[model samples]
Target: MGTEFLNIKDSVDAKNLIQEYFNKYYEPEGEEIPIEDSNGRVVFEDIYAKIDFPPFDRALKDGFAIKSEDSFGASEENPKVLKVIDALEAGSYSKKTVENGLAVEISTGSPLPEGADSVLMFEYSLKNGDEVELYTSVTPTQDVGKKGSDVKEGNLLIKKGTVLSASKIGVLAAQGFTTVKVYKKPNISIISTGNELTELGEELKPSKIYDVNSYMIKNAAESIGASGTIKGIVKDDYNQLKSKILECLEEYDILICSGGTSAGVGDVLKHVLDEIGEVKLHGIAVQPGKPTILGVIGEKLVIGLPGNPVSSLVIFNVFVAPAIRSLLGLKESSLKKVEGKLTKRIHSAIGREQYQLVKYDDGKVEPIFKDSGAIFSLARADGYVNVSKNTELVEEGEIVEVNLFN
Candidate 1:
């Protein structure tokens, strides 16, 4: 064992360093993709409505289009009668206009004919021969979908940097958009380092474990809209690690590696980073992830996570996830958090910020304290609560914010 970290930074300072570096160098470009594939993608530019929704006045129900005055004083006892001039269905326009005492039979979504200001629903009118007897009165525009009522022309529909959802895509489809301009997804390469790690599905040799960090970290990046490619596992050999990282940097926007980040005889990731690129940060003052590393090579960013599975994911969520989101032009505040009361008291290292894993259930948060290397700790946890460095203990029944994994 060796003292690997000489100078450690607080978690807040570490986050600021990442933000400052990415803000200066990373500027994502936009690409046009089919609208059907735009969901969950970030918008590169503001999208405006080119035309009005409903383009023209249309019927909101299967009914008759008529002047509102023509239905005045209409009731079950004393009904008003109007001659049906023409019948209109959706996508068809009627050239005929409604005059006084005249109505046009209209189907739902059909464009309202000229000289009509209201629609009488079929339930309120009885068709007798070519005339409809109205049993109820209506006001102008009643049961009528007016032009530009839902969306007006030239209105800003989607703002830049907004993530497209199903509803937003529907709005674009309504405007006849077959494709949309979205920020290109950032490509990230995920690597796991350790001689004790073996590839999944391979026969597990004695004293070796299957590689978990590569698959775990890859999915985490992809969940946030970045394209992830797993580069498999690398041993503790410095030259091999350096060659792999350099190759990945040539093509990927970011490279993330887990394991072999701590200061030990077998930990060679720091030495490789020092020779190939500038190490911006060597350690962070956070529990379960103090040996986290951040670096930059050329224009691409590099991150090293702890060997411990729990520590690796916690640091990724706190530090790497935001960087990925920034490069994709998405909001950094995407993690969902909820408030809950602690089920029991908890203690932490006074000088280090602690991310205490907890199982949140119906506003109650129960601490799940397991060793950092324990992968099951993360599986049992719904989220974690950030305990400040200055605070050493949190009493039971105290309220805290839990950052959810999903």
Candidate 2:
């Protein structure tokens, strides 16, 4: 039996329904992983500093460490002279203390001497043998970095649910953390279904095309921190397709099948979902990807996307990517976008949201109109423009928001 198209859902409502169902039943779990492998992963718990950063009063400049009282009122006109007592490099400490007429030569990051309270920059001081003349007055604690001033012990470092960046990794290293707790990546299974699909290494036949959706979808999943594997292709056979999907659901958190989602006689993905599990959504009011399917089987989410490369990618970016992020407790706006002006007018179906592939030029976006099934449709474009379902025509020179594919 053909699936119903009379009740195709609005794209926004469909996404909301998926999110609500996910929040009700799914809870993301966490695991401890090495910091080296934790980049881009969401933090599972709050992290705190175990010890104070710097851990000691350090020098902020390469100059002389001295008592501010001795350098007080000193200037270029009448320089103050002091004997060098000792020299301290970075990671070294001084045993001798600075007296009234003595100074300690200190390098940046060197611990402040016992009796020295300020650092005099080398530019402001002149050295002749062991005696130095200070030409500028320095206040107490000037150019001195105090311990615990930057990061105090037991202070919160990274808050829960924050995405770990390279800078955050450095912060964890400062806290002496070799490993961190992060949300576990969702495991996904991708199956490309079509009688006209062939493997990459196989010789091309007139009627068959290489399976691009499987590999493309796999990388798309990986982009969102989800581990995806191609579970091979399933031809247009109801029994075999149903068996493979059921088997995949047993081992994966999400099952994604490309093709066979339309209302044609050969499109049996929706029927298979109905037979084995729940078909939550049959179609969406979207251009190029109106034949999308969203369902659930057992505890796993099952999604069927169109066979066309451009349509498959658009649907995954709009639906699957966000769903994967939500399962991992990540924000929906994780992907960044830019806004630009349209170079020309574009038309869209009044009742369906349209995504047109476009190239961004000096602040102007030029739409790329090509066959959806052609690989060059998206290859020549930098990003895509979203036109609302109610928007029938977009005029030239209009400011439009562009969603980059990267």
Candidate 3:
């Protein structure tokens, strides 16, 4: 008898869907030159140290190099005197060999002489005639830094797909890398849809709102070091929406259309994506964003986010943010999610995941307005709290992880 495969629908969580969608698409990747150019770019290659840091052993102090045994038992009460056979300046290499009871004068960063194993501070000893007196005892390897102490040659510095930072550049430079290779930055495109919307500078008519999605989304793209181009506003017509998205998709790796995912406005944006390519997932069981659409547009990406500013940003933070990071080839972002106490109880229905927009103040989180459409509420927010479907209605004083915007 043949067994039937169990069709487990809804078993795949948001994470699983995210992973499945991620595995299907290979983001745009390329190589870039220069250290600063690699800042937002992802590491395409594992970077190894070509040479050891501090390549050579040098004097750690502007003092005299001497044998450790020569300064043994020397103290402030009774000082030991050794002849300063020769003096070496900074950047100079000392060839003199310090035998027993002999000291070689050396400056900071100067290479240690052939036989010297320690250095004595200038303050502890006085130089008179041709010799210097040491008042302190010295230990083996005292005041001497060893080569490769900071880093070793051939050691892995940064793995591929790691976004290089300022300090990362310093490490590469230390490894003698004047030029570093990294993935090229992705080009982002932003478009807003709504017949009742006008541009920012235009006069706001009574029932119509100005186009805020384009500016806001473009700013978000710029924040991540992404190059953004506003494709202007597309009327809530399916044909126009289709034409605009398809046209902009050609010039950008990621195309974003905001405000038309809802059912009321004919959902021209959502339909455009479906007609062009397969919509991976239509509705997410999440709050602040339910009509979210994630789809593949040929080799590019087209996302249909909610029209509400707060809802759109919430979805961006939850889903699109990681996608952007993946596209940039950045390492796992070090964005810390902080836990804060809830100021009041929040009731949410069981079934859909909820991302509550809350303002953190004095170690507490306060929910925003009833709806996530309020833009001003979002502006004042610090982060969000993710409430699972099965577990809703958080009591006051309960601690929750808050994703800080900063």
Candidate 4:
């Protein structure tokens, strides 16, 4: 087993380095999925409108559809009276055409009657028997949605690599798409190491802790549309850990193991991966999670995260999460963030980058101080502020951006 920590990279440098590898070697595969099941997935191809939005000229409000010239010179005192030939509601089409002194009553979203050039609101028209009296004049296309006004046929509605959200799904549905082509989600296998770790629902022995990192990382991957599995726990034995990882690498695109990553005597995850595959990086210059390992065996990527629960989750968020997103063909620029004022001062070392867990309240944030092993440490945190490696102190009342967990 290799005990030396060589080629330790800066946090940001490590992410870019890993991302370049994925971009060069990994090509995202696509699958057709029902539009209802596409939310949170990435669109594999550009989606163009099959038909013009609205499909036809439609009424924007409940009104009388008429030729604009017919309502010209009309006033409340001396109104222009037109015979109502037909009435149409939403989803209903009118066969009757507005010609000469004839008009059609139309509801919002109803296709405009043939030959009608404009609509006069009901407030500006009085209905008596079959006649509608227009009290005000209207211009062409006034209160009327023209055909292809919203979106034109063959126009790009969604670009390739766009994340499928509820609104994006609605756009696809509006175009009569029942299914869409989307990038396949990556399969990630998680293994928690350390003999001191106990499975949930098992008896808690002295000096033993419940497994938390595995579940946390699994859910995090799931949130980003990756399929994740917990492969149980492995004691600090090299052979057991190596075999499990080797087996998982055959079936999974990414393997993540929490614990046994730090350079302690018992830390064997890095050594095992190094022996079987290649360890690209064994450590990062980041606080609380400096002992992260990035490696590759064949085409599969393996990550060894810190044993501490908080550190594991934080490192996963900063590095592993983005990598998973990249596997799904998502861009890192899509990460959402918001700026807030820090309620208190935050101090960090000058060399290593730091991510301070914080609680956000009404645009103000305060650091969450908890031990790494505390179960509620992350639960109480709403987000984190990434303090760069070059800076030392973020003074109180300073504005900083937070990347929310959600």
Best by lDDT: 1
Candidate 2 Cα errors over 4 Å, as ranges: 1-6
Model 2 lDDT per residue over 124-230, tens place: 99999999999999999999999898999999999999999999999999889999999999889999999999988999899999999999999989988899999
lDDT of 3 by residue, 1-406 (tens): 1111122123135446655665566555666587755555567788888988778877899888998999988888899999998899987886778988888888998888878888998988989988988999889888898788877898888998676778888787767777777666668788888887898888999989888778887887766656789989888888888888888887777788888776563566656666788677666767878777767878777887888888888777677766666666653456657778898888887877788888988777887755776777867888888887788689999998888766
TM-scores of all models?
A: 0.96, 0.93, 0.86, 0.90
Please write out the lDDT profile of model 4 over residues 1-406, one tens digit for every residue.
3386777899979888777766765788999999999888898989899999979888998999999999999999999999999998889989887898999999999999889999999999999999999999999999988889989999999999998889989989999999999999888899999989999999999999999999999999998889999999999999999999999988888899999988788889888887899888888998778899888888878888999988998888898888779778877787878889999998989999998999888999898867666669787898889999988999989999999888
- What lDDT is reached at residue 386 by model 4? 95
Whose lDDT is higher: candidate 3's or candidate 4's? 4
TM-score-better candidate, 1 vs 4 = 1
lDDT per model vs. reference = 0.90, 0.89, 0.77, 0.89
Q: Where's the lowest-lDDT run of ten residues in candidate 1?
A: 1-10
Return whichever of 3 and 4 wins on TM-score: 4
Superior candidate under TM-score, 1 versus 2: 1
Clashes of each: 0, 0, 1, 0
Off-target runs (Cα >4 Å) in candidate 1 are 1-3
Give the distance in Å from residue 220's predicted Cα in candidate 3 to where it truly belongs.
3.4
Ranking the candidates on TM-score from highest down gives 1, 2, 4, 3
Model 1 per-residue lDDT tens digits across residues 1-406 = 2436857999999988888887766887899999999999999999999999979999999999999999989999999999999998888989998989999999999999999999999999899999899999999999999999988999998899888999999999999999999988888899999999999999999999989889889888888888999998999998899999999998888899998788898998888888888899999999979998888888778889998889999999998788778878877566699999999998998999999999999999999989898898888999899999999999999999999988
| Native-to-model Cα distance after best TM-score fit, residue 49 in candidate 1, in Å | 0.7
